[model samples]
Target chain A: MQIFFSPFSPYVRKCLVTAHELGLSDRVQLLPSNANPVTRDQDIIAKNPLGKVPTFITDDGVVLYDSRVICEYLNEMGNGSLLPSGGAARWDALTLQALADGILDGALLARYEDVARPEALRWPEWRAAQLDKAQTSLAHLQAHPALLAPGRVDIGTLTVACALWYLDLRFPDFGWRERFAAVAAWYESFSQRPSLQASWALPPA
Target chain B: MQIFFSPFSPYVRKCLVTAHELGLSDRVQLLPSNANPVTRDQDIIAKNPLGKVPTFITDDGVVLYDSRVICEYLNEMGNGSLLPSGGAARWDALTLQALADGILDGALLARYEDVARPEALRWPEWRAAQLDKAQTSLAHLQAHPALLAPGRVDIGTLTVACALWYLDLRFPDFGWRERFAAVAAWYESFSQRPSLQASWALPPA
Candidate 1:
C-alpha cells in the first residue's frame, strides 16, 4: 500500500500509529504530499476529492482516507483490538474518536485563523471560538482521564494523544498541561513511544 | 432516544432522515437546540463537549453525536439495510458520505464567513477557499450521480441530499444545477420523499 503523507499532520500520524500497532508499517510506503485550499496536490485530488492527507492506496489499488476510516480498515487487517467488536464499547471508542478528532479540527481552524489569513482579514472572535471548542473538549478529557490509560490506548486514546501533541506543536502557550494534569501525565509517557517519535515533525508556521 | 437538535443544522437533519428511513423516528424526540462560539448551549455541552448537534441521548442514557456515528447506531437498531453489509459497497457509501459531509462543512464555513463574522473582518479569499472545496466535491458527486439514486438512499445519498438542500437554503444564488445536471435531477426527485420533507426546515437567516 502507498500513503500520501505529511510528518506533521496529526491525522496522518494517527494512521501511521495504527499501521505500526497493526504490524503493517513495513507493508506501506510513504509518498510525501501536501494539499491546501489554494494549491491542491493533484496526487491527493485524484485519490481524495477532499485533497487531504493520510490518503491511502491499498496494494489492490483501493483508495481510502480521512484517518478514521483508514484506521478502521487497518484495524480490521490487524488485531481488531483498536476498536471493540460489538455493543457499547464500540460506541464508546467511536464517540471518543469523534471527540478527539473534533478537537483537532477546531485547533487546526484556530491556527488557520491566526496565521493563514492576512492580518487585516483575521477574525479574533472566530479564532477564540475555535480555541474554546478545543479547550472545552480538553477539559472533558481531563475530567475523564481514565480514557487515556494503557488498556484504553485504542483509537480513542491514540487520537486524544495526537490532539494534545498538536496543541503542543501549534499552540504551546495554550498551557494545557497546567490545566489538564491527568491528560498531561498520560501524554508524557505515550509520547516516548517509537511510532509517535518517528512521526513527529514541527508543523509549518 | 432524545436528540438535542437544531432545524437549521444539516447534520441534525441527516440524523432525523436516518431515523425516518430506519423506522426509528417516532422512538426519538427532537429537543430543539443550537450551539456556537458566542453562546454554547449548556444542554448540548453537557452531553457533547464539542457542543454540536445531533447530540443524542439513548434510553439507557448513552449519548452520541457527530452525525455519522449516530446514523450507524440508528441503522443497527433499524433494518440494518442502510449501510451495505460489507465489501466495496460499504466503503463506497462511507467514502461518499465523507465527501458530502466535507461539502456541507465547507458551505457552512462559507456562510459563517459572510454572516457570523463582522463585515470588515470578512475574508473573500477564505470564503472562496471554502466554496471551492464544496464545488470540487459537488463535481465528484455529479460524476457519480448513480450513487444518488432511489436504490442507493443510504447514509451517503442522504448526506449528499441534505448538503445540496443546504446549498439551496443558504446560497440560493450559487446555482449548482447549471453545472451538475445529473446530481440536480437526482436531488429534485429525492427531495420530495416523505423522509426528506419531514426533516426539512428553513434555516435561520
Candidate 2:
C-alpha cells in the first residue's frame, strides 16, 4: 500500500504513529506530496477531492483519506489493536479521538490564518477563538488523565499527543504547559514510546 | 439511547436522518441543547467535552459525538444498513462523508467568524478561503452525481446533502444553484425525503 503524506501535518503523524504501533509500517510505502491546503494541488485533489494529507491507497487499489478512517483501516488489518472491542469504553475512546482531532482543526485554522493571510487582514480574535477551543479541549483531557494511559493508547491518546505536539510547534508562546501541567507530563512520558519516538521525528520540509 | 442534538446543526441532522432511515430513530430520545461554540453550555460540555451537538448517549449511557461515529453506531445497531458491508464501496462512502464534513466545517467557521466574533474582528479573506473550500467540495460532488443516487444513500450522500442545506442557510449568496446546477437539483430532491423533512427544523437559541 502507498500512503501519500505531507511532512508537517499532524494528521499524517497520527497515521504514521498508528501504523508503527500496529507493526504495519513496512507495509506502507510513504510517498511525499506537496498538497498544502492554502495552495491547491490539482493532482492530489483529483485523488482526494479535499486534497488533504494521509491519503492511503491500499494494495488492492482502494483510496482512503482522512486520518481517522485510515488509522481504523490499518488497525483492522492488524488485529484491531488501536480501537477497543465494544461498548462504553469504545465510544469514549472514539469521542476522545474526535475531541483531539477538533483541537488539531482549530490549531491548523489559526496557523493558516496567520500565515496565509496578510498582516493587515489577520484576525487576532479569530486566532484567539481557535486557541480558546484548543485550550478548552486540553483542559478537559488533563482533568481525565487516565485517558492518556499506555494501555489505553487508542486513537484518542495518539491524536491528543499529536495535537499537543502541533501546539508546541506553532504556538510555543501559548503557555499550554503552564496551565495543562498534567497533560504536559503525560505527553512528556508518552512521547518516549518507540512508536511515538520514531514518528515524532520532525519532518525536514 | 438518547441523542442530544440541535436541529439546525447539519451534523446533528445527518445523524438523525440516518437513524430514522435505518429504523433506529424510535430507540433514540432527542434532547434539546443550546450549545453554541462561542458560549458552549456547561451541561452540554459535561455530556460532550467538545460541546458539539448530536451527542448520542447509548442505552449503556455512553456518549458518542462526531456525526460519523454516532451514525456508525446507529448503523451497527440496525444491522449495518447505512454503510456498505466492506470494500472499495465502503471506503468511497466514508471518504465522501469526510469531504462533506469538511465542507460543513469550513462553512461553520466562516459563519462563526461573522456571528461569534465582534464585527471589527471579521476577516473577509478567511471567509473567502472557507467559501472556496466549500465551493470546491461542491463542484467535485456535482461532477460525480452517481455518488448521490437514491437507495444508495450511504453516509457520504447524506452528509453531502446536509452540507448543501447548511450552505443554503448560511451562504445563499454563493449562487451554488447556478454554478452547480446538478448538485442543486440533487439536494432539492433529497431534501424532500421524509427523514430529511423530520430533521429540518432550525436550531433553538
Candidate 3:
C-alpha cells in the first residue's frame, strides 16, 4: 500500500504509528505529499477529493482515508490488536481516538490562523477558540491518565501521543505541559516507544 | 441516549438521522444546545471537550461523541443493520462516510469565515478554498451515483445527504444543483425519505 503523507501532519503521523504498531509499516510505502488548503496536490486529490493526508491505497488499489478509517482498516487487516472487537472497551478506544483527533484538528486550525492566513486577516479570537479544544482535551486526558497506560498503545493512544507531539513541534510554547502535568508526563514516557521514535516527523525546514 | 444538539448543525442532523435509521430515535432524546467558537456550552464541553454538538451520553453513563463515534455506538446498541458488519462492504460504507464528513467539515469552516468572523476578517479566498472541498466531493459523488442508491442508506449515504442539505441551508448559492445534475436528482428523491424528512434540520434562526 502507498500512503500519501506529510510528516508534519498529525493525522499522517497517526496512520504511520498505527501501521508500525500493527507491524505493517514495512509493507507500505509513504509518498511525501503536501495536502493542505494552499498546496493541494492534484495526484493526491485524485485519490482523495478531500485533499487530506493519510490517504492510504491498498495493494488491491482500494483507497482508504481520513486517519480514523485507515487505522481501523489496518487493524482489521492485521490482528485487530489495536482496537477491541466489541462492548464498552471498543467504544472507549474509539471515543479516545475521536478526542485525540479532535485535538489535532483544533490545533491545526489554530496554527493555520497564525501561519496560513495573511497577518492582517489572522483572527486571534478564532485562534483562541480553536486552541481551547486542545487545552480542554489535554486536561481531559490528564484526568483519565489510564488511557496512557503502557502496552495499551492502540490507535487511540497513538493518536493522542501524535497530537501532543504535533503541538510540541508547532506550538512549542503553548504551555500545555505546565497545565496538563499528567498528560505531559504520559507523553514523556510514551515518546520512547520504537514506533513513535521511528516515525518521528522531520524537523521543520 | 441524550444528544446535545443544535438543529442547524449537519453533524447533529447526522446523529439524529442515524438514530432514526437504527430504530432508536425515540430512545434518544435531543437536548437543544449551542457549541460554537463564540458560544461554548459548559455542559456540552464537559461531555465533549471539543465543545461540539452531537455529543451523546448513553443511559449507562458512557459518553460518546463527534457524531461518527456516537452513530457507531447507536448502530451497535440497536441491530447494527444501518452499517455493514464486516468485509469490503463495511469499508466501502466507512470510506464514504469519511468523504462526506470531510465535506461537512470544510463547508462549516467556510460558513464560519463569514458568519463567525467580523466582516473585515472575512477571507474570500479561504472561504472559496473550503467550498472547493464540498464541490470536489460532491462531484465525486455525482460521478459515482451508485453511492446514492435508494436502498443503501447507510452511515455514508446519510452523511452525504446531510452535507448537501447543509450546503442548501447555509450556502444556498453554492450552485451545487446546477453543477452536479445527478447528485441534485438523487438529493431531490432522497430528501423525501421518511427518515430524512422527519429529521430535517430547522432553518437557521
Candidate 3 error regions (>4 Å) = A200-205, B200-205
Best model number under DockQ: 3
Error of 3 at A203 (Å): 16
Task: State the DockQ, from 0 to 1, for candidate 1.
Answer: 0.63
Residues A1-205, candidate 3: write the lDDT tens digits: 8898686888888888888888898888877676777656778889899888889999899988888888988999888678888898888899899998888888899888888888888888888888888888888888876777766767788888888888999998899999988787888888899888985443344
In model 1, which regions exceed 4 Å deviation? Answer: A200-205, B200-205
Candidate 2 TM-score, true structure as reference: 0.89
- lDDT by residue (A1-205, candidate 1, tens digit) is 8788787788888998888877888887887687675566777877777788878887889888678778887887776688776689888888999999988888988888777787898877778778888888878888875666565668888788788888889998999888878878888888777766765443354
Rank the models by TM-score, top first: 3, 1, 2
What ordering of candidates by DockQ runs from best to worst?
3, 1, 2
Give per-residue CA lDDT, model 2, range B1-205, as digits (tens). Answer: 8887676788888998898888887778878788676666667778776666877888887778888889988988988657786666778888889888888887888898778766766667667766777878778877887777756678888888888888988888989999988887888888887777774443455
Question: How is the predicted docking of candidate 2 categorized under the CAPRI scheme?
Answer: acceptable
Please state the error at residue B57 of candidate 2 in Å.
Answer: 2.2
Q: After best superposition, candidate 3 residue A191: deviation in angstroms? A: 1.5
How far residue A48's Cα lies from its native spot in candidate 3, in Å, is 1.0
Query: Model 2 chain B — which ten-residue stretch has the worst lDDT?
Result: B196-205
What is the DockQ (computed on Cα atoms) for candidate 2? 0.48
